[model samples]
Target: MKAAITLESVTIRTELRPGDIGYVIYMHGDIYSKEYGYSLGFESYVAESFVEFYKQYDANLDRVWVCEHNEKIIGFLLLMHRGKAAQLRYFIMEKPYRGIGLGKKLMNLYMNELNSLGYESSYLLTVDELPAAASLYKRHGFRLTEEKPFSDFGKPLMEQKYELMLR
Candidate 1:
């Protein structure tokens, strides 16, 4: 079993390393499958979006927070720049890392960056299964603008879109 990690043992880094994306992808597949019963399609979708994020990445306009414990990734989130807005993606943490302040720390950092970067607006897409995330987004001034029931992830779910206007 993995040893317990105290909050002080956690570290948040902004730079992406060589294997970070792959590890993030693997974590999503492994963690979600066990926790939420998410299927392989969800992981595939994450990979495709991560590929797009990497391809279009701009140091000036994009940001990511990689949370590590004992030099291993435990959580992460990304803020991707769109035409005149920001898109939040891949905000995730391992099961053991939840109920802690790390997610809020990432959100606070992401929100501050979004507000200061001069984006006209910001948005993200998520499934209704993620109530905790939605709650965090709402607390950070994001509002649910749209939702549609879909099976694209190989399961019945509501695809939700949340938006925040910075301008």
Candidate 2:
């Protein structure tokens, strides 16, 4: 982690460092399994995505924010360059950190950064099971654009795509 920005009691880091990528993978794996009953498949998918992101990471176009409290990572969000647009990925906050306005703060920071980067639009894919997160996305001007049933993580789920025109 690098470049910490303190917001209240939480510190948000804007740069990705050694072992931080692995921490993200592990955090998602552990938290999702505990919260949503997701299996190892989800972890594998996250790891693969991280590998791809690592291979093509451009600091000028791609940004990651890691939120830490008491020197421990508790939340994170990623903004990735996608052609002329952008993609929001790997957004998660630990249960204890939710409902305290951290999500909204992180999102506001993300949108401001996206705007500064000149992205015209942004999109993200997530499952319908996370209603709180979906609500947050909706509040941030993202609209549900697509949905489909899938059993990718050893369970039936409605995969949803949300998009926002960032003009």
TM per candidate: 0.95, 0.94
Best by TM-score: 1
Give all candidates' CA lDDT scores: 0.91, 0.90
Candidate 2 lowest-lDDT run of ten: 1-10
Error of 2 at 47 (Å): 0.5
Error of 1 at 11 (Å): 0.6
| Shift of residue 119 alpha carbon in model 2, Å | 0.5
Candidate 1 TM-score over all chains jointly: 0.95
What is the TM-score (0 to 1) of candidate 2?
A: 0.94
**What lDDT would candidate 2 get against the real structure?**
0.90
Q: Give lDDT tens digits, candidate 2, residues 40-152.
A: 99999999998988898999999999999898888999999898789999998887778778899989999999899999999999999999889999999999999999877
Name the 10 consecutive residues with the lowest summed lDDT in model 1.
2-11
